[model samples]
Target: MASDVEDGVCFHCLQPIPHGVELSVAFQGDDKAVCCAGCQAVAETIIEHGLTAYYKHRDLDKPQQTPLLPEQLKELDVYDNPDVQSDFVRNTGDHSKQTTLTVNNITCGACAWLIERELAKTPGMIKSVVNVSNQRLHIEWDGSIIKLSDIIARLARIGYQALPFQQNQIEANINARRKGFIKRLGVAGLATMQVMMIAFALYFGVVSDLDPTTQQYLWVVSLVFATPVILYSGQPFYKSALKSIQAGSVNMDVPVSIALIGAYIASLYAVIIGRGEVYFESISMFTFFLLTGRFLELLAKEKALKFSTNRLTYMPNLAHREYDGGLEDIAAKQLKINDIIVIKPGETIPADGVLLSDKASVDESLLTGESRPVTKATGDGIVAGSVNQSATLRIKVTATAQQTVLAGIVAMQDAALADKPKVQKAIDHIAQYFVMTLLAIAAVTFLVWSWFDPDHALWVTLAVLVATCPCALSLAAPTSITGAVHRLNRMNVLVKGAQLLESVKHLDTVVFDKTGTLTYGQFKLIAREDYADIDTINAIVSGLEQRSEHPIAAALSQLSDQPISPDAIQNYPGQGILAEIAGTDYRLGRCEFIQIWHPNWQPKRQSNVILANRQAVLAEFQVDDEVREDSHDVICA
Candidate 1:
């Protein structure tokens, strides 16, 4: 390789260096040929850290072929401003700011690992984690010393593009990925059917003593159909395998790519020579099934991530802000600190602010996991994402869009995703070595069969490669963990780390931080009128109750034995509902709701639903929070 360097060979990658290159570096007292300025910079960084041992270590590993740009070395002072950093950066109580960036051009796990390693070398950087599944990088650094743009620039220099993470961008990327996979799957499925039909016809013709020319023609047609199935649908596996090998590690894709390419090459040679048997049908079938499994798995991952995107819903799309001496509608992201915003009943609070009104009740179930509404008075601080249950109020904004406590929680969750749990790390360590062991076994099988049955050696080796590909083995743990996460998310139980699953199993006792954690904290029926009269009233009461989502409406809805059909249901924002049920035209809501229709009806002032007709009071339902039936069983378990 050193002799060929003078003839335009790269000393670092050992590939033919292109012309118009002035890149060179001195290593071990000799001038080495580098393909570009990026290679020279990487070589210098490795040697500067006394990591020249990697040069000798990577000799047996495949060299990287990624193209890097030199223009990314420009200064990044703009990111140091606090206003610009507020868009995507979150503060963790001190000078440290955490940011999650979506990266492009990540082909495999090694690319993520390389980006992480390079980022850790920067000054004032606390830590960097790269999630290979989504190609997202989570970084925490001190803003006082380093800026956000510097980290992004470093990633660009190493053949990757880094930008502030956005949900819409990720959704678009997922759609594109799904479309590509579906198209490939369709092509492979169609090709497999055509090839299998040709193969069956050829086999039957042999028994019927068909002519040689017709059999050759059918074989040629089958080869043409199988070609696209192997090259197009099977391309992803080969690309992943190459990246893994270049990074000095082996992944499950190595064996899969080998099996696919090997079978295609063998079958292609057989068809061209017209003497050996062809396995065109077998190759096409395998490719189709593989693509099908991969597409389904991709969909499952997309759904799992979709559950996580709910965190973004905390920020409202629009906010009512004080502007030009009156309230005006504006995008939530445009709101600045000290801006006063009005929030109505049942509306989600758009930002963290201080209450400017006398009193209000807010339900912060999304953040605190508490079902009961908490009361707040004037000058009290309110959090973003909490619902204003009752009473409209004005609040002065204290934090911007990405700097709120809710955004901080989202940033923490993302940071947790980038870190590997103990069990996951162990699994990854075992998987890396397992790939090497399989390669060795395949080699031994080939040599043993070549001694006695030389013609069957390649066939036996291919079978071994396919049978022990390790795809299922590597996927088993992640799939189970992902399903568990989906189930827990539905229950409002958020788990940030995978190791928590194993760790919780070994605990002697479990603890909850709040009352709602162990109890339902929802209203249950406490008192009612006579059943004979209540049953008749409940049938009419279910009409208005079913239409409202209020907790009281839900509690009342559970009393009726059957669902009642109601018509002309009208909702009053701050008061209640008025509907015509069974042509009785009853009103079931607060005392005010009944008084609106009947001026003489005087209902008691208490926590109860007033049910009345046009003339008199019919029945009243009382409710309160009671301990859940399953709470005791759950505590014991």
Candidate 2:
């Protein structure tokens, strides 16, 4: 059977197409054949530009082409509908739905804390975790107690804009935030350097010839430079602090904002009187350092890119929906259970369904660990993210978009952010209490100092506030987690939350899978012995393994400068790979898998990746992963 693209069937008209025309249309992020250039350009242009004039302004004889209508402007209550909720909300418990929402205007840790604090009062909110790095909210609530719309409305009431999570929203948010933060950071950084230079002349008398009249000039100049840094670059601190206070709580930024505003006022008073001290340099310097640290942390998080598979990111947004013995392209989210759909070879199976085709081959690598394609026939269950391999398939959908296994995996990922580890919770509580107590202490110290030395009371209080700002204490758990999470993410490990790693001490008994959990999933190379030629084996092995996604394959990928492509490449999941390299058949895998090619071959150890040709074992490579540090101690204890 010929594929539609190869059969020269025009995607636009479904007519016999000219072979040499080479015109195509992009449909649902994939290319399709078109019979003529005119058919290709107009439809694609309309789709891309949303031009409805061609249809709307057409004459009546044009058969009344359907006018493209704007998607209805939605009220938040629309999310309460199961049809709309099906996109980003998934059932997680008997009466609960877990939701992932992309949020905007979250600038600091305090914003996240304020969100969590406010939502804690909502009756149905089981959990809410706001990630400041990417501004995503992972929330779960009992459907019986409240609705998703109410959750979103509450977020809006707290000065946040939220919508159903979309794949690109987080990235878009980060990019927008990065641009704005860069501008603010540049202001603070340059102003800090200027203020510091002027401060040196005033503080240490750097210019011996500098006199009182000139000194007053330099102090005013320092104040001039520091003004914009405090007002503009320091906006985030003030906004987050005000939100926290308005919500009837204190956050780390409460101290920060207090110090920033208090110092700026004191500095202004000193410049006016020409009689006292100013901390314009401290204000500028502190803001610059804070912004710098946050910028680097964001870059690290950007490097710790998400594993897109967890969200089925590769799945097409549109699918071929079977309608009355014909197929129509429609949004995949619009698919319903029992809706039949066509799956051509090389296309991803869109939703969980049962195969209706007589026979088909599917690459179920995403659902199962097996890399080799699996054969299926009528009535066999199919998965959403699997790729159709050999023949075209018609599948009767068994589950809708939200009910698919891939969506379930995404829901589980959201649930990972549900709650805090007990110790982290304790630390956060202490930090909050510490803020309240320190404010009291600063007030008392000011009162006592005013009695002994009225001249310096304001400075003493300002010093107490700035020096004791509990930013580090308040940020300990989150900062520690992101730093560690960034490292683990580089190794393809996704940590659920601070609890997963930090709460291990509370586990009395621990159990872990051998390959990826008890030990690092990576396989370290020990040696490569008795190869036909070092370069040849390296090229052959690298070529095959580089094309594969198996864990062990990564260890040998760096052996060659470039991989040599093989012919007739075949992968046997639990056995080995069979291929032809340079007109010679080669096998690489377990000793047992290589035994057919070289019968007398034996593995030197309990495990080895042996490479063999027709006659003898050409190479035996050793690989191992040391048990994770303290694994034994934790399990025994």
Candidate 3:
């Protein structure tokens, strides 16, 4: 291979390296010749990410192709253009621009720490925060000191690819990220199991009559199996540790990475010297567990985000706007106040508006908790996110996009998330110094062990670092809050912030609003007084109620399982029902209407409906609000 490379062949692609060409890539501490800038970039990207082992692990016959860029990269420069920036980037202040980007290949909190640390060193950076759960990078920077493209290019060098966040593509990005984590975790799990099997065989070799060469062979096999676990599955730990140290700070990952790598190196050295013990199983197991914890956190964060986005999903990207003389579909965000828009049957309302049509039936369950369709007439106000359940209607816009009520709910969720609880802020402050203290303990451990027993100093120190890394303390708090909020959303409770969660333990007096909160808004039959035969009452009431569209009619309709046809029925809107059955006139309505027939008759109890004839009162009916199933338990708890 060396002679072939010396004969004018590119070291990477095996293509002919042109005479006097100067392209090269650093690999394994040496420069290797390449055919062009593309080959150079590809080689450098591979090496810088600690993936140079791919050069050896890959099949020999694999074809090499290149798509790379030079130091003055052109592809990233497109992001610097104002047109490209307009999609995701926005000006927050005169000198500051902020954006949210989906970051690729983040496995844990340490990756977030690394990104933040590096960005803080840049000249123009104001702030950079990584949401480990969503794998998103939120950045704010001053434009005077650096360009946005340059910041992105800096991320590329640190082994991450970032793109402007697109809501339509969020689920796809989440799936891809989940798949990558699963792949890495699976590799670590399988490799750990195999190494443990080998570990048992090596233990047998030590205590039994196994030959020296056989024991050596088992150790070598363990090394081979553990290599991938350390290099690929455990890549994020090492990467984060290096960046943390380079930034003159310490992260929880620093101790973990040091312990894991230290063990591997120590075991490898012992293997080569043909003496001492190996800990491949320990290394493999650590990688698997760390990945499992991060995966769970990712899932919890995803669930929280889903609950938050459920409201926003009702917003349609386009709305039918009445333009000049014809209807045109335009971006919903472009809609303005008083803009007339057409809503078809079964389509969601694009904005809050007033009805221009004579009449329409709308399903407002998504916006309001009410399940029944509301009947709206001309000049009645309608809100966005309601579905038109009847005929097509034209509405004049009152609020569009973010100005709508649905957007306010979404914004409240964002505001709640932004306002961190006192405990979380305190924990964050402690966690910063937590790693430094762990390092101090490690230093004390190393020095004490070195004086007592020189040979075991490194091993004991590594064990201390690994056993007490404090990873769970730093991760558990925020994820628990997110998970709690998500669970509450499932129960139809909207939690504004972590303050509610933190203060739950001290909850004393619980006050609840009556209708639609503690109790269902739909009326429930409570009591009834009858002066007429039960059979006659059931048939007549069912017939009368079946004719009207009012909500109370449905409740009264339940008074009978079977329906009876009345000779004639008439509905007095917002009043009562008038019907005739068996040559008798029946009135089911206001007590005042009943009093007209019986001048001295009066109701003895509180009632919703009074059934009477011209002679006397026949029956009285009462309704009560139905309470929710959990209302009692919630109050007591």
Among all windows of ten consecutive residues in candidate 2, which has the lowest summed lDDT? 64-73
Report lDDT (Cα) of residue 444, candidate 1.
98
Off by over 4 Å in 1: 1-85, 103-125, 130-136, 144-163, 201-215, 245-249, 436-454, 512-525, 529-621
Model 1 lDDT, residue 86, Cα: 62
- The lowest-lDDT stretch of 10 consecutive residues in candidate 3 is 64-73
Comparing 1 with 3 on TM-score, the higher-scoring candidate is: 1
- lDDT string for model 1 (538-626, tens) is 77777567766556677888667775767677765445667777686777777777788777766454446777777677876676666
Candidate 3 Cα misplacement greater than 4 A, ranges: 1-168, 242-249, 306-309, 316-318, 323-338, 344-347, 354-381, 387-392, 521-625, 629-637
Q: What clash count goes with each model?
A: 0, 0, 0
Compared with the true structure, all predictions reach lDDT values of 0.72, 0.72, 0.73
lDDT of 2 by residue, 341-452 (tens): 9987579888999999887768775654344467787899998898876556899998767788878876775556435566556666687678889889989989999999
Residues 1-637 of candidate 3 have per-residue lDDT tens digits of 2222454556655555655566577766677887654345446555655555546543334333221222333443545655445435666568787777767656445556667777989999997866555666778899878888788778867767676664533554555557778999989999999999999888787678778898889889999999999999987778767766665666678899999999999999999999887899998998899989877777776666676545766676679999897999986756888999999866889899999998877877676667456888899999899888656789999977555777666545544654457776666667767778888888999999999998899999999999988787667766676677768878777777757888888987867756577888776777889998988787778778777655556688877877688898766543577788878887887777676677787777888788886667889888666789999987788
After superposition on all C-alphas, the RMSD of every candidate to the true structure, in Å, is 13.4, 11.2, 12.5
Cα deviation at 286, candidate 2, in Å, is: 1.5
- Give the winner by lDDT: 2 or 3: 3
